[model samples]
Target: MDRVFSFQASGVCINTQHHLDALCVYFSDRDQLDSLEFYSDLEASLKSAVLLPDCVVMIASRKFCEDIKEYWSNDVLKASFVTRGERSGKPFIKYYYLYCWETSGLVEVFSHCADADVKPCFNLSICDLVQQGLYHLVKENNVVQIAPVGHLFKHPSGTRNNIFIQARELAKTEPELCFVGRSISLAFGFERFAKLSVVYIDSMGIYHFVQEALSFCKVDARIHSFHSYDEMRKLTPPPIEHLIVISASTSGGMARDLRNDQGFSDSRILTLIDKSDSDRSGKVLIALESVDKNIFDFEADNFETEIELVGEHFSSKAKPPRAVTLGRPHTPPKLLKFLKEFGRDGLNSLNEIIDGQPKVLSLVTEKVSRNKVFLKWLEEEVSWNITVAIDTVICTDDLGSIEIANTVADLISTHKVGSARPTVCVYRNVDWSSVSNATGVLVVTAVARDGGLLREISRDLRENLNSEINCPRHYLTAVGLPQSKETWSRLKQFLERNASERLYGFSEWLVLPIGSDRQSNHWSDLAALAKTSQVVEVESSVVSKSVVDASLDLVSDAIRKGFNGFLPKTDGSDLALSSGFIYFGDVFKDDLESALHATSYLAIASALQKARDIDDVANQLRSTGYESVILSPECFLRFNDNILHACILRGCRKGELDYSSSPHHSKLMGEFLLKVFSRHQLPYGAAAVEFAAALATQRLKLKKNDQERLVGKVVNSLKDEPSALLGLLLMVDLPRVSMLSIK
Candidate 1:
């Protein structure tokens, strides 16, 4: 058996020679340094090399597998390369690309040797390397600037510093925090405090940065944060005389509240601004000298300059006061295009295989990693496009689609595109007056089958905007679409309107078009349809079976009383509770929505009455032509109720993650959810609050702090209602309520 070791050394490499020199110093203490050899020509090295087996081979510049058009052979032992770091887009170099080579000996060795026996050489993360590189850059570069929107700290030469400028922008609109926390550590008499907590409101964008900044300042105090005033009121400790409240910007609402509620004096609180204004009358103000920008003139890049010129050109033409201005349709990146195709092909491939999620995900991750494209598109691209003004609107009705739309809107607001914030609302409920003067409109959907709903949306949108002289840029975006070309054609025709211009409309899909018509209805939509569609009288025996379960009696009773006591549906749809416990019978012929809803309810009712397992219930739903959107992690998050969430999780355990023509199969969603939540991903505002509730009640073994971090403000709003959680768990096919933790 061969013992291979892997280590990562990430830092900026000026050129090829610089990278080699860095590698030599990085591997100075390793035994492998004695036999390590570098090769630029991969083909020559593979064919001509016949040296010692102990040698660690390296190939540079091009990706090894791509250059050779094949993966490594069985004889190869180990491979290393200098590649880009995960986060930093600068001239980064990562050491040891491949820890172990594909070899016949290793395959056999793996059968006998467990993973626990083979210890890794190093455990340094890419983030650690990025920080190291940033530290080096701060020392080397005399002139640096943080991009206004992206919050990237970088050299004037455009080389990235790999440090995020979190507090400078997210907290305020005035002069951004130019100096790093370390620079400000000695300023504003911050070092005078022997022990003081740095306090601020917690947000997904600014919380981590606050801690990082405090640590960078070499402060020794505990950091305190709250999501809102309510959280602050309930959870805040009694008044601490030495506490020093801090704000990155001049905004002092949190500071003011802390003063009034916790009795912190105005002199104790500090705001990093040049001067305190009337709005921040009571707080202390601190300022640092502006850095010298003479060495690096702050000028907009060509791309930004071009966008501005285009906007000016468009504005030059005569237009109506409320006319929608057309912003240029930015071309999608090639990497994103490749991902779409890869996703489409992968989806098609999954349809032909069973239990292939692990293999499929492994393949996708490997392929993506090979190209060194770390998948954080929303954080990177979408955030970069946010505008400060209200220039766009994302319209969607599907709860899953609502999440995506909300993500886009939040990113725009978090990172001003060009100082424009986008709005997200249901197409039916969209306030025309609010969005009428907007620059662009986007119609989004989770999935589109035959394109009927899309066409309906397009027609409605066109009608709404008919009063305007010029149409703004509009796009039809979807997570998934039908595999059929005919379906796509119909959609294009509706948007294009018969051999004319595109009418300021375009279509962009997150995944490749490879969904089936059977999977058209969204799961949330199905649930809504079941809850509101006309109810028919069922036999008393059927009702008796459901009533005997005892767990669902309260829910049934609540439904009978029009959900008076229970919380209103999160989607803002009214529930017309029927007089009796209605369950659909056979011979139900209706639209796809009604059909799927009926089948889903019937399946659950049958499972409950017959005391069958979830699998049996799932099978019944699938056999009855019940199909809905394959809940992605983004979609699975739509299920606020523990019952539906458990159903989704049960589907995940069955290796069903991809879009299915039938119900109860989607392992990908589970994996995605675990990955997303593990990273503490959030959509922002009310949407994030809803998602947090779903995550909190799902019994997923998440830590208390993690749950609080996911949604600090919303958790307080959820009263200590153990009875509600207990009732929800009991009414469905889930483990006993005792096993679940009450948030």
Candidate 2:
């Protein structure tokens, strides 16, 4: 065997060149320096030194020597030497160390023989050394004979502390092991070896630190950490062959229990007790079935020495078994059934799935509003705590849509009594911008003339609303309400032709005659349908008075029941009715102006009655002699009718209320008109007289035959107002009397 030697330089400071020179002299040949590998970077020759063919030499630091002694002791020998170097450019002496080993033990064992006898010794091998007990081969061609520089026969502290080394040795044959402790140091030592499957059990609190330390060291091992024994028990144990119990005190019972109860019966158990404990023994004796085992104290021994012993023992044992696989246990049938019934497939089964999993049923049916079946089911099967049902109604007409929307909105707002059973939301037209992105049921009502419009709305909802709504069980429904049979037929054809392709592309569409006698039945069906639906959508024409009224009635009923209410469109039919009044007034002029005045007066009276303060203000004004200021019925009707007509015209031209102009002015004008109309009523004769005067005024602008025809109609309307008709005829002849001057 080829002999190798290692030298460790230890001092405050040492010179590389001087050490090399001294080494050359000691070896008696300058070429022997070629075998040295130096640790310093100062000398190029030393830095680049290569090993000799026969012997290998290395110069390293004391720390490196200690490390080598710990791990590679079987392959290396260590010793120390003192040398001289320059301190501040003067001569200084320092201690240098060395570690050496024989590459081939045969040559060293037979070195006393001459060159001629060297060939005979070539037949000798490492097996012969092991039998002689003069040397031991840790592995093939690796011999360890020399005692390390600081080898301990017994712990100086009188405690047998060699568990780390013993544990490491055991690990070589049993790579799968369990460690029961909170000692970070033990984990650090254990992580150094690769291909280890280690289960580390500690109190829950320190598991984080252990994981952090392992991460810091970049440990590559199969490691499972648990905070409690129960947590550890939950895991399928790897094929454990060793158990290391590290504790602050000697607890042999823990080790024995882990070995017997944790399916680690075949595993070897090792205990390492901390030295600081009062009951700790120098060498703990554990009672086993077959023998008394000795547990070691780990604090009294040097960590590196222990490591060396373990490394030697590891090299001597057979390779560890392959890692054990940990797999998930089979799930119970009951749990599997519950998961299957509560998952995506179950939702399609609808109410049937709610039979067994009542908790899941609660999640779907809780707070359901307007859906009677769901509410009734909840009341009977679940809890009466299901207090409110929310219904969403949408009006989808372009004409008079806002008025219907406002009416529905107002009804919903006012109908909310304390804790009503159901609440409702009426969206005039679907304002995609205002829709919430929250996950829930959405009911959409779309009223469109053609299937193309319905399809467009559906596409918009899909693009803007569907993906944004995160609720898994949500549904979308569209309802079409047509006024007449012709319209209903046209709508039905459009829906049938394009529903699947367009309307049903996103949701289901239903067509119903809203103004028909079955309106209540349709709503009742809808309420029941809502129970099964996550979202409910009803599409109806805003212009359909029956549809609007029916939607409002449903919302009102819900509110009256004291349910939670949400109405986005919260104004009465004032806008629509007022607009209608204006339309009729413009067409009929003075002839129907009295009727429009009566409607406006009634609206004001209704508003006053609802708002007591406003009513009181009106009462106070009447009591202050304001009634004396009231104008005659004809003049009052003409003046306010002109204001109403102008306001309507402004709204028609601009498509919105001009609060700063006509509408605002009309409001103030209405207050005055209300005061007059409240105090007096226009009789049929006065209305007819006003109509005749208005016709007479228009006759002045017509041709000869047109004037005669207009006079005939005025005479017929004023049969009981001959005096008023004569006054109108007189006024018609006055070329200077302008119609505008009448007001």
Highest lDDT among the candidates is held by which one?
1
Off by over 4 Å in 2: 1-443, 446-455, 461-743
Per-prediction TM-score to the true structure, in the order listed: 0.21, 0.16
TM-score of 2: 0.16
| Model 1 steric clash total | 17
Task: Kindly list the per-residue Cα lDDT of model 1 for residues 401-422, writing each as its tens digit.
Answer: 6665666676666666356456
* TM-score quality measure for candidate 1: 0.21
On the 0 to 100 scale, the lDDT of residue 557 in model 2 is 40
Q: lDDT, candidate 1, residue 417? A: 38
lDDT of 2 at 499: 19
